[model samples]
Target: MKYMSICIISFFNLIFFSISLFIMSLYFIMNEYVIFLEWEVVSLNSLSIVMTFLFDWMSLMFMSFVLLISSLVIYYSKEYMSGDLNINRFIMLVLMFVLSMMLLIISPNLISILLGWDGLGLISYCLVIYFNNVKSYNAGMLTALMNRIGDVALLLAIAWMLNYGSWNYYYYLDYMKNDNNMMLIGGLVMLAAMTKSAQIPFSSWLPAAMAAPTPVSALVHSSTLVTAGIYLLIRFNLLLVNTWMSQLLLLISGLTMFMSGLGANFEFDLKKIIALSTLSQLGLMMMILSMGYYKLAFFHLLTHALFKALLFMCAGMIIHNMNNFQDLRLMGGLSIYMPLTSSCFNIANLALCGMPFLAGFYSKDLILEIASLSVLNMFIYYLFYFSTGLTVCYSFRLVYYSMTGELNCSSLNVLNNEGWIMLKGMLGLMFMSIIGGSMLSWLIFLTPPMICLPSLMKFMTLLVCVIGGLIGYFISKISLFFINKSLNNYMTSLFVGSMWFMPYISTYGLINYSLKIGMNTFKNFDQGWIEFIGSQNLYNKLVNFSKFNNVVMNNNLKIYLLIFILWIMILMMFLMFL
Candidate 1:
């Protein structure tokens, strides 16, 4: 059985590798060709729409990230879910989702993009409910509902484009370059992006999505599905540049970043904490997208995929070994029992916390630099800087609380090795998370290489991360001081004590008012004059009304019959005269 699983996993990896190579080769070829050829539409049909595939540097970079993370996830899932009853079904869904996402990445038209967009949503919902538990089912449904809202926006935008303007991609592209209505389309697209990316109000579904299997959470939420919205915005950057929609995106993105970070602090479930972190990081990516630096956003997405997946997988390993306990309070000093897992977790956390020389530092620092240099409002730049502090706080808290505290589990079942297959997958990602940024710099068409950060700024960012981590460590220690007296009192007052009672109060008030109105109306209707007429002996009243109605209808029928006969006579005389 183990050998069979290994063979199956290896086959999938081979297939993905071949496809990735094909995509990269095509990207290079088309990128050169697009510069010389006139933009042309190839086909337009109900089933599919294919355009002259243009490969800019940004698209190439995104495609590469998608391919890399997707391949790693598939490899990891085989071991992680090996003994599951529906492993084959799970793998099939993962493959289908990956194919659809790849199609979305390269899709040229709005319709093709939506096809891929909804495909990701569908597969993700399936994966979230893979466990067949009620919680998983409910979470999947919530995610589907939220994503459907975004899907509707995209659908409406497509309809508007087709009916009001042109249905073809090239036509729309031409129109966007010169049309005044670009703002309307841009706004609609931004709404669609916000929902898919899980920004602000739409973000509530993502945290609940932690009910999914950790691999699903790691792959879909951390890497691909959540990034699709940012991909859409970047794909249509030219249309969104220098618009009010861009400013709105920046504002919402900043708010989401801060709010999700704060929410992570309150969460005790390990997966949910990571889920919130994904949301926060995605918000930051959206903010970077708003700055019109698609490359930087893509860079952040790629680096995040490596580290975040590692974190989730490590969390999964820890939970799986512990019989699926997810609370951080139950996990303490895992570093001694699971050294490799703990080490991998810390490395990924270091990357996530933006430690110097790690992959996250390179990408995150680029975003901060871009934000600082942005021609937009200065407040946004400062907001981005402030959010970094929160990012560090939550990220380090996850690491410290899980790995640094005293070992609390009794009679630990210490496995000599966590499964080699799973370890291999983690090691692959850990390698990438360490050096993926420099490699990405070489792959893309950017100046001075991405690794070449200004020394002073790099030092300051590193200092911020260290300071944030230390502060977070101390705060977690003193958290118990507030946990018992003040924390409980505060939560009780804020939620359970005051505003929590409002629903019952409101319901009672509504019922009471409704009864009062009903009683008054009933009293008015029961007034003696109308009641006296209605209360006349029922049998006699019915008989009299029936007789009156019958007499009136009979008289009317006779009169109509006479008039018809007279009209017929007149017509006959007139015909004879003629």
Candidate 2:
């Protein structure tokens, strides 16, 4: 019964998705764009607080896609989490996430955006800790606190924006585009976006967030939470273009793509591999956006959502059949047992590799073509294409390990294609993965991206694809005996395999040092100096003063008798003098 209700909600959302998409398309074609719906809520002497919703092709199309993916995830979860005792609560949280994302999509006001931003963080934490285990709790805390840093950054941006006298950032993005203060605002927004999108120092929480149910992983990593940052930057791209911050962003995002790709290659957890891939794609989006290709970045963002969500769902199915085992080393010969799921996985993986005519192809290829044509230095240029190759390299490695290799598990696996409900959910995305890029390219862009490059430059993607495939294939098959026997194996393997020590730096390095400082402060200040000077010393002084007063009072009777005798003698002397 709870399942049916969730399905009904999903079906309802699908209708809304279709209608919203249609309206967005019509609005785009008519070119009568940008509807602002506002209602005054409060008024001060000269200030007004109003509720505002911005409707345009960007927001509408994005919201529609979010709803579509969310609905599918809801449907998918029905099967994936059917055995959970708290499925109803889980569905409610998912619904809340959808609502929060929608609020974020429509709001042009910074204050309103906070509602959504914070909702995403809080709800994501709840989702991450839903399993009520130690790992879940730790991962949830890490995810929440890491995101909270971004939340704080955004609040700072909002405070800085008060210099403009309003929270409506849409109005100020253009007006304050060139102001230095605006640069600060943009910087803060970028910091916020970076944390949310898992760039650099903030990237660890993303893979850790995989502790959540795979449905949440699908929705959060793919379209909702991670994309929130990219989407924010896309909205603010006008202010960011040509700024030093944007250049800095380009550098950081490029490195992120490279690092995440390298990390994915070294990762063994199946879901973590996919999560790292999502991180790499996010970096790609941010990199392009930093280069001022806002439309292309947004286009890729939408296309990525389709294939990535499907990829996570595919991973979920495999994990489910494996009885919660998510290690790629233990997952082999899965294709023989679960052909349909494997096919879906392969298709998603290919799309992720940016194969021609697939969803990732249209946007990714255009971005590459644009990157190649840009007036960039050799470092950025090489990083861009090399990361592209790394993407395919890790992808093929993942494919070979899980699908084409020997059955490496310790026990016999009976993988079945019986999750009809989950399969149904995947089918929708599969169709989208095949056609979403082309469809989005047509609707989002007025003209196809013009590419004029040498044949070698044009074929660079294909060349890398081939090279990566061969390398991945051979590397997967090769024995690591020589490397294992080397003295440096532990150090080298630890660095690469542990995401370059990010988990350690984020958790132990940062947390331990902070705790150490806190303990020192507690022992020396709160328990030592403050106790001596403020509490213990003051109490001792009061006790000593009371004891002195008591002794003086006890001697009062003797003092009074002596005073009476002295007064009588003084009166007699005065009479004799008179």
Stretch of 10 with least lDDT, candidate 1: 496-505
lDDT of 1 by residue, 494-517 (tens): 643222333233334447888988
Top candidate, metric TM-score: 2
**Every candidate's lDDT:** 0.74, 0.89
State TM-scores per candidate.
0.79, 0.88
Clash pairs for candidate 2:
none
Q: Give a tens-digit lDDT track for model 2, residues 348-429.
A: 9999999999999999999999998999999989889888888998899899889986777767677799999999999999
